[model samples]
Target: METNRNSNIIKLKQNLKYRNILIDAFPLLGLIIIILFFTIITSGNLLTLNNLKIILNQMFLYLIGGLGSVYLYAQGGIDVSMASNIGFSAILGVRIMYQHVGIGIIATLLIGSSIGLLMGIIYAYAGIPVFIQGLAMDFLLKGTLYPLSGFKASIPVPDRLLKFDNKYFAWIFLLIIFIFIFFTYNFSRFGKECRSIGAGEIASIQSGIKVKKNKVLAFFISGLTCGIVAVYTLIRTGSASQSTGLGFNFNVMLSLVLGGCVLGGGNGVKVRNAVIGAVTFVVLQNGLVLCGASARAQDIVKGILFVLMIVFTSKMYERKV
Candidate 1:
């Protein structure tokens, strides 16, 4: 009986190992399928040089936001207010640019970081649920953004500020941000702690990790990245408007999920999820547009995909148990 039980246990472990391997491969496979599907539908127009650049341009904000969000997601938390936050920051940056370009940039970063820190504080110390707090903040920021942005008017950046909008500059900036996030997330104690908290917050607390502090820091990083994204948006678009970050929050979430990042958070989360998800999301959006899908139709498709991802993620976790 002992020998038989041991054999069964070994077999179970092997089965689980194989299951996980297959599960981990899903995102890459999905990406490939999406690419092929869109390429075919668009008659190969989807991957042309000009189109590729457009996809890359569309990817920057999502990628930046997704990278910053890894920390929050790793801790099983999310800030749905990020879109409003970015918009507000960009508005401030644009307004300030009228005074001084350098200071405007500084203001944007500070505003973004400050809002993030504030959100962190409320989340950590106020004992509020992250989702609730995020929604409240989102509403508050939207309220502020509309009035400040003149309710549908666009605030154009100074001509001098537009000089920073070169494609090469953007690519170089993305590389720098990617390098920083990669190392900080993989090599630092903070990242490990965030994952630990996500895996089991009570257990993490018992293990002597400062859960509250980590939460605040994670949010701060997220905010800082939002600020960076705002700068990028401002430079590229040369303006801030009421719709500056429209649909951005959901887009970022979609990108991360598409890349296989489980919002439920766990030790299994990988940084590559952000990169892959962002690229896939942009390509998907670009392709849909090229196919002449209406905005409403695109949104409906995204909604369906989001629901499917949630179901699939839940099943994967259940199987692991």
Candidate 2:
């Protein structure tokens, strides 16, 4: 009887180990497996350097938006108007960049950060909820820019200012920033407080976490990222149009979920998850384009993936009685 019980325990341990492997591989493992299958089907044309570069370029803003939302989502708060903030700031920044490089860029970012900071202050201090604030921001920004740009107002983005989209330099610069954020989140006091607040805001406040202040700081950080991405956006397009940021609202949300972040607080909210999810999204799109998928079709596919990812990653908790 003793020998039989020991045998059963050993078998259970082996099965648990196998399950852990499967769980860890679930993220991107599907993406890799699909890529391998398609590579064989496409005769290895899917793995070219050109395709990879295209995918990386597409991933730029996805990663940016993902990392920016990390602190917000982790803290049980989110701002969907980030794209609008970008759009609103793009008009201000790109317009400034038309002449002076040094002063224009600085002024644009300061203005961009200020725009987002306004939303944060309303939500954090004025006792206004984030959802309403974000909605108001979206409407306010869209309405404000729609008439101002005058539809097809072709504003020139200078070559000197366009160096960020230089492919090589952008990669290096973003990588350095990613590394810095990773380390900060991994080994900083802010990271701990964020987790505490995420776990329970009331408890964190009771524990002296300064919940409101940190929440505002998170938005401010997100605004800083918005400023950086605004510069990149102008560079990539080389010309700003009225419709520059009309419908990017969903893209920001998609980037967050794709990064394995849950809507409510207290879940997987890592910078790496968002980066990987963005990469996967970009690569999948690049591959589809290579296979002659139309841009319209790609939009439909993106919507499908967004739904599927949300469903698969859904979380439910129950209390034991």
Candidate 3:
């Protein structure tokens, strides 16, 4: 019966392989399920063209911020200062453009990203820890927002600023931006080096990966994404507030984790995963709001779902038997 037992083992392994493929694809499946449920729950309310625009708008905003975050992921680190970065930069960029020569939108992005590049340099080369680096950036940026605004919450943002957030503009802009970055990162030597660094820094360095440069570039892009995302945020709300980026740290981190990037780093590092994860959270929140759930209840549910995602994505539970 030894030969029969061997045949059975082979079959079992094949079955298990298919099972994993499904499990791995579950997040995308879950996204579809949520959309269907959303269609049924809100019926006409959420099924309208305007509603769809709104969803796209939110997605546009979050994904831009999360894009920088994906860079951090690809580089084996994290940037928790997203909300603060966006808010402060929005306030700062607007004021600078309005008061002086109007560096315009593109220039504003450069400034925000420069700040991020500086932060990354400090972290990667100065030997500062990533966690501390993130926390410090968040605080420093947050503190800068109020003073930069001259303690004003209602900065008169130029109407010209609205162009970036316009639906068509965001659609075209985000599409080109992400696709370009995605391919550039996945296909280039720099991209390869970033993932290598994430996989194992010491090993990557030994292999001549230029770890610090890649990390700095990644952080700079992330900062630029923050600025890009902020453009949308300003459009949606029409004004930047002290609380504009109040809870971004938690939201961005949640999106990253849900996307299947491990806590410490090192994975296949896909930006598509980040997009999918952000969509999951957005759908969850939208569903809760439609169901008339309280904010507190929604928060609790989100926490529970995140935990579930962690469990599902965990490798610790692999069964050998």
Instruction: Tell me, by lDDT, which candidate is best.
Output: 1
lDDT of 2 by residue, 221-254 (tens): 7777777767777788876665665555566666
Q: Could you tell which candidate, 1 or 2, scores higher by TM-score?
A: 1
> Each model's TM-score, in the order given?
0.91, 0.85, 0.87
- Listed per candidate, the RMSD to the true structure in angstroms reads 2.4, 3.5, 3.1
> Lowest lDDT 10-mer window, candidate 3?
312-321
211-285 in candidate 1: lDDT tens per residue? Answer: 999999999998998889888889888899867877787888888888888888866566888998998888878
| lDDT tens digits by residue: candidate 3, 1-321 | 999999999999998887767766666776777778777877756657876666666666666666666667777787777778878877867676665424746656776688788878998889988878888888888777888878886676677665545577667877887798788777878777877787799999898778888888888888887777665666666677667767875787777566654555555466766788777777777777887778999889878878877776655224312
State model 3's lDDT: 0.72
Local distance difference test values of all predictions, in order: 0.87, 0.71, 0.72
Worst 10 residues of 2 by lDDT: 312-321
Candidate 2 residue pairs in clash (backbone atoms < 3 Å) = none
Q: Where does candidate 1 stray beyond 4 Å?
A: 1-15, 150-152, 293-300
Ranked by lDDT, the better of candidates 1 and 3 is 1
Error of 1 at 169 (Å): 1.8
